[model samples]
Target: MEEVEVVVAHSERATLRVGEVFLKVDADQSRIDVEVEAMSLAPVPTPKVLWRKPPVLAIAALPGATLGRLGGPSTGSPAAWAAAGAAIRKLHDAPLPPRTGRAGRSIVALAAELDAECEALVANGVLPGDLVTRNRQVAEAALRPWTPVFTHGDLQIAHVFVDAGEVTGIIDWSEAGRGDALYDLATFTLGHEEHLDDVIGGYGTDLDLDLDVIHGWWSLRSLLAVRWLIEHGFDPFAPGCEVDVLRARM
Candidate 1:
């Protein structure tokens, strides 16, 4: 394996240049561990919300020529879902640092941010249509009785790293925060329905989470994701499809 040279550095960000690779470093802990990627850019922009404390564990680089192809399909398998669920559950159950009533930012702040993003999208000719309005209503309803649990705001397959049937590490903590736990589940199951049942099933039998609320928030999140993509130059009606399915189901 070749060692990548750290070419750019910031207090909270860095960039590494390898022979034929460019790794964008999002989080690094004391030069001992790092969360990085060789991709040209992240799929979504990081939110400007200050939520969780800096990560404790350091992520040592996994030796490989290509970091993109490191994880395989099995990461979404039933066994892998179980392992991921266990890991997520542990994260949620961990005693959260004292909530000053604002570590996660207020739901009102989130709505304001979403509205600003939506306006930017419309300005760029990416109309979110009725989806934007629907999201506002759903968000208001969901935030009424919010439970501030630790949530990996962007808990999707791409952020999970698996090896030999176990979750070796989780990447992309840029969105980590205190919010509804179900929102995390919704984000995880956004487009891939194949493993949703398994993922939800593995959430365990202890907590009595409201299914309707979860689905509602999931729908809203899907819309937000689509809007973001459109604003960033992606065609909403592209061959891959958009969040219409999620909207209809909601």
Candidate 2:
């Protein structure tokens, strides 16, 4: 018998690692369905699905370390980051998956949502009023519509595994669905902005990306996530953390 390692335990989901097997227990079956189906459809490297039995998804552990951690400097070389970018590009270029209930967020709706959330943050005194306002303004550019691409929904650095400077696998496809491509890019570089060029270079084409929109997504993501993280008993205000990411945008 091996000791069960708690990889992450949140209200909606919990992941436990035992030996070479990782078990993800999610309360939402639709999320799990998206994960399983997306992995099947994605052209990029992903964890091997060992088995599934409602609420529990058993997967084989990947062979490499994660690309990096949020709020921490990445030890991955520029090449590794580039490889991740290339991998994401490949995933994006693949055929679209079947339409689940999830749809891309409309800019108008996103704007309204951002407005409400920013007001809540200020009203609750969760963050400085100026900081919230500034980020709210920055998030405006990202609200515009664009052709939807298959997005990993939550493409955090920790979900990307690299071995020998190559992206061996990506995990946590629960959020995989049609969405804005820049949102994926923004999420990847949220706390690791320095690696943006490496990521863009590896994406294997000039995307003519609007830097402002990218920055906007960064602000929007951090702002929205801060409250959730805090409610979950996780501190986003830690030095050089989510709060730092938002402040950096200012």
Candidate 3:
């Protein structure tokens, strides 16, 4: 391992080395740095949400190679999905700090938030086809009584890292929140249909995931992706064809 001193302070963003490892540095007083070993696989990039942090100053240790590759999904396969699901279940079972504040009164409030996000997308000249309406209905329905569990908020193949068919760790915890457990299921299913059964099976009845709730989360996530694309100058309509198809079904 090579040790280097910080000449200039950058940001607290995580950096990765392609097919190697990931390094996350904190800008706080301690200047804590975390390094996670990368599994020997990559995931396919689908529409997914990721947390954002400050930038990092890149110091090249190896010649002609970048520090890490930003964006994109892991090489999530059936085994990888199974591993990810297992990891997720373990995380859910772990103790979490108590949640505070009235984030939402009920499903209605959650639905309202989804609606507002969709409306804002449209108002900003981004046409998400029928994703907004579809998501609203799903959100309202999913708000019914269900076991509340910790959610990665953006749980998807992209956010998952795998090596040797085992999930080493999960990345991008910025959107971590408390919500319906099904939300994570939805995210996994929508992006990794082939591994849907495996992921659900891994959940192992610890929590009952309603199909409606999963569908609702799928719609909400799709809309969020489209909105992001629009804002970032990516062709939302073209890249979000799957979301459009789901909207049509709705």
Candidate 4:
């Protein structure tokens, strides 16, 4: 019998690995719908949909290893990172999806939310006030206007898979939709600033990307993530994690 490996388990969702298939159990059907639809629409490589049984969506695992994990050394070379960036560029150039996603949220709403989260991070003594304020200032750069494109809203390193310096697949499409292209850039390169240049080399200069905005998203994401991470049993402050990313700014 194949051992059921728990990939991730949280209140909102859980994923179990059974041999070559990954079974995703999400309470929100809409997210599953989005994942399925986005995979179909995406121009880049995506996991094969094995089947869908209501709360459980089974997908064939990609053959390549993940690009990297947060708070860990990246096994991918600069070429592999560039390939991932190229893939992202292709995804962004694709036609927009019907529904809005994380990157599609209104700037005003996001700003308000960031403010509230910053306050909470300080009040709850999660992060130093100075650290929060500095990053909050940096986060402001990303609040400005941007052209929306199809985006993998959560393009974390772990979501991307690579082999032989080429992108094999990208996963976790529930947060995928039309949104700011830079948000995807920032999210993918979040903690791994060292490879930002290689990624941009493949992504091209057409994005008119402002480094500050990338840094802002870094801060904005970290501040917003601290509470949720703690509550969900994740350690944002772990070395090379969210807190370290924030501290690197100061």
Task: Judging by TM-score against the true structure, name the best candidate.
Answer: 4
Q: Write the per-residue lDDT of candidate 1 for residues 1-250, one digit (tens) a residue.
A: 8787875455566656555444554455532121222111222222122222344322334321211211123335577676666666766665553322122556777667767766665676654556656655664544545667766656766666656556665655645556677777665655554566676666686886666666666555655566655545555455323455345554
| Model 2 TM | 0.96
Candidate 3 — which pairs collide?
A: 16-68, 39-163, 42-74, 42-75, 43-73, 43-74, 43-75, 73-158
Q: Show where candidate 3 strays beyond 4 Å.
A: 1-75, 98-108, 121-125, 128-131, 233-235, 238-245, 248-250
Candidate 4 residue pairs that clash: none
lDDT of 2 at 153: 82
Q: Model 4, which residues run further than 4 Å from truth?
A: none
TM-score of every model versus the real structure: 0.63, 0.96, 0.63, 0.98
The residue-by-residue lDDT of candidate 3 on 44-78, one tens digit each, is 21112222243332222221211111132335556
lDDT tens readout by residue for model 2, 7-66: 999899999999999999999998999999999988988999999998899999998898
Clashes of each: 0, 0, 8, 0
Tens-digit lDDT track of model 4 for 169-233 = 99899999989988999999888999999999989887688998898888888889989999998
What does candidate 1 score in Cα RMSD to the true structure?
8.5
Q: Estimate every model's Cα lDDT from 0 to 1.
A: 0.53, 0.87, 0.50, 0.92
Per-candidate alpha-carbon RMSD to the true structure: 8.5, 1.4, 8.7, 0.8
How many clashing pairs in candidate 2?
0
TM-score of decoy 1: 0.63
